[model samples]
Target: MAWIILLIVGFVGGTVGSIAGLGGGIVIVPSLLFLETSLGVISNMGPQIIVGTSYLVLIATGLSSTIAYMKQKKVDFNSGFIFFIGSGPGAIVGALINRFFETDQFAGVFGLLMIGISLLMFFTKSIKPIGIIKTGKLHTYTDENGMSWEYKYSTILAIIICFFIGILSGLFGIGGGSLLVPIMLLLFGFPTAVAIPTSMFIVFLSGITGSVTHVSLGNVHWLYALALIPGAWFGARFGAYLNRKLNEKVVVTIFRLILIIIGFRMVINAIIG
Candidate 1:
């Protein structure tokens, strides 16, 4: 039953994640925490284990989505790679910091972070690209359908934001796409179409780094993670397909609601426990 639940959760997570460019970790982590609490699966260690497992699931989901996005030529490899450079080291630092928190403490922090992310997602409005800085080398990308986009941003700002996102990713076992996508859209003025795939690519890199760190810390449960793999892979493909079809505003609205609900639940649980 537990295995079955994990599989189902993984599929749902992957699907919504890919479509919203939020990554599976946002869904997987909270769902796993709720499941464990309800089922009495692991007692005191449940939250930590759930976080670890979410990262593992994220690795698979991120890779699958990134591939799909790549095939569509929707990903900006240059910008994504630049973000990845900062994320890698930041993930390691976050993992190291995670070692100091107790399970409840971790849950509290994760929940609060989720709430903050939800608020950011909810309040942000779409804006046209403006005040383009012409100093840096312009990065241009052409999608599979011959659509082109060009943009430039401060390298230092990109690094700072990506590094912070990576820390949250590693600490909470999120893939960082939830935060990254929004940052790209709001801060860097990236188009929705461009931000989703580019964020997925960055998430893939950070997921790998965070997953490795969690594995080294003995936080990941291999059996649970293994159960999630197949479902996440197929679901991610389906979600990426839907990304082309669905309305971005609708997707983001749903994403924000889910985050708020889960975030509140986790925070309450932490306080009560």
Candidate 2:
């Protein structure tokens, strides 16, 4: 029954993730916790296991999705590499921090954090690009590959943002897509399609780094994570198709609502527990 529930969660999380450009951590963690709680299956350690397992499953989804997007010319490899160059170190730091918390405490804090981020994503309106300079206009440039580049801010600013996002990813075992995608689109002015693939690319390494860290601490549930990947992959493909068919605003609205609900549930559970 738990395996069956995981498959359902995987489908829901993957579909929503594909559409929203998040790796689905926002939904995955809460859903697992809720399921574990309802079943009364060692609730104390369930949250940590959920985090570890989600990242493990994400490794599969991220690799598959990244390859698919790269083949379609959706990913900007140079840009992704640059962003992740700084993020790699940050992830390690975040993982170290994660290891310090007790299971129940981590779960509560993690749940509340998800809820806050979700609310922010839902309510926040337009956040304009940060300029290359404090006073400069947002500029778009074409690269040698004919890919469009918008460096609203300086390279330094971009690096800073990536570093912070990476830290968050490591700490929470999230893919950082939920946070990175919006910032990339709204702040860097990257196109939605580009942002989606880039988010996947970024999440790949972050997920691996976090997963490795969790594994070292004996927090991962390998079999459980493996069980959900097939369903997640299929759901991702379907969700990607749906993403192309929907309007951007409508997609975002629905995605935000899903985030809010998941976030709220996590917060509520945290409080109760």
Candidate 3:
């Protein structure tokens, strides 16, 4: 019964996450805690273990979504690669450091981060393409649906931003997409379509790195993570499909609302627990 609930949570998380480019952690982490508190299954599980398990689940979610996005030719491989260069190592460091915080301390920090992201998303305007494509520095591409996009950004700047995003991902087990998507859109000038898929790809790499570290530390609960994978896999593909059909503004607005709600919940949980 508890496993069933987790599977359902995974499906919902994967669907919303793929569409919003926020990854499954936003739903998976909190839902897991809710289940544990309500069902009393895994009552001994600590927050670190929960976070580690979330990273494992994210590995599956990211892979499924990336494959779907690749089929649509929506992924920006070059940009993903650049972001991974910094995020990959940062994830390892974050995972290693995660054990240092108490459960409530981690929750407080995660809550604060989510709130910051929510506010940023709420106030930010839609991003437009820069419209200039340099041969080596900037590039233009068309998606499978025939929409074209062009973008230009500083590689150093993106790397620095992604490194911090990876640390937060590793620390909180949120897959870093919540931060990455907005930064790519508002700061680096990526289109919503491009940012969604590219962020997933980067999350895939960073998630794997963080998961490995957690595994080495024996922080992962394999049975729980395995249960989440099947639902997350199918849900991610469906969500990616929806991403093509929905209005970008609508998607972002919904994403922001989710962040605000989840952030508030986390803060309250930390305060009361």
Candidate 4:
């Protein structure tokens, strides 16, 4: 029965995450806590274990979505490469440090981070594409392999953003796709299509790094993670397709509303705890 609830959570999370460009942690963790309490699978280690196991699930789901995006040429490898260069190493370091903390503390920290991200979503207004792409002074370049590229300040910002994202990924067992996609779209000026693919690429690296860390720290629950994979994979693909059909403004509005709810929940939980 608890497992069934996890599947439902994964299904819903995959769909919401696909539309919002998140890795699904914000949805998954809260759902797990609620399910665990309802189902009486009480364990002091539940939160940390859930987080660790979720990253393993993220790898499978994220990998499939990445392939979907790559085949469509929606991935921006140039930015991905730069972000990877920074995040990969940072995640390794963060994962190693995670072994020192207890689950309750980790949950508190995760909630705080979510609250910050949610507030940022509420306050941030317009996203401009002008400077992030080639204008009169900027020009697109083509590599020998025939792939086209545009250089922008957003690429530099991506590297900086990944540094912090790496720490969050390691600490929370998340792929960091939640933070990566929005930053890619808003800060880097990537289109929705391009941001989705690039965010997936970032998730691929970050999830693997965090998963390895959790495994080494003996925090992972392999069986549980495996159980959630099938639902998340199929749901992710379906969600990705739906995202393409929505209007940008409508999508942004809905996304912000979800963040607000999640954020408020986190803050309230923090205060109560």
Off by over 4 Å in 1: 41-45, 126-134, 141-148
- TM-score of structure candidate 3: 0.91
Give per-candidate clash totals: 0, 2, 0, 0
What tens digits encode model 4's per-residue C-alpha lDDT throughout 184-246?
Answer: 556555555667767777777777877887787776766666667777777677667776677
lDDT of 2 by residue, 138-249 (tens): 5554533677765444566777888888777777767788788867766677766778877887777777877887788777777677667776776666666676678867
The runs of at least 3 residues in candidate 2 whose Cα sits more than 4 Å from the true structure, single-residue gaps closed, are: 41-45, 123-125, 130-153
Query: What residue runs in model 4 are displaced by over 4 Å at the alpha carbon?
Result: 37-44, 123-151, 154-157
Error of 3 at 46 (Å): 1.5
Backbone clash pairs in model 2 (N, Cα, C under 3 Å; residues 3+ apart or in different chains), count: 2
lDDT of 3 at 30: 72
**lDDT by residue (tens digit), candidate 1, 11-37:** 999998899788888888877777666
Weakest lDDT window of 10 consecutive positions for candidate 4: 130-139
Candidate 2 lDDT at 108 equals 72
**Candidate 3 C-alpha lDDT tens digits along 31-53:** 77667754576555577898899
Provide the lowest-lDDT 10-residue window in model 1. Answer: 125-134
The deviation in Å at residue 22 for candidate 2 is 0.7
Give residue 160's error in model 2 in angstroms.
Answer: 2.5
* Candidate RMSDs in order: 2.1, 3.6, 2.5, 4.4
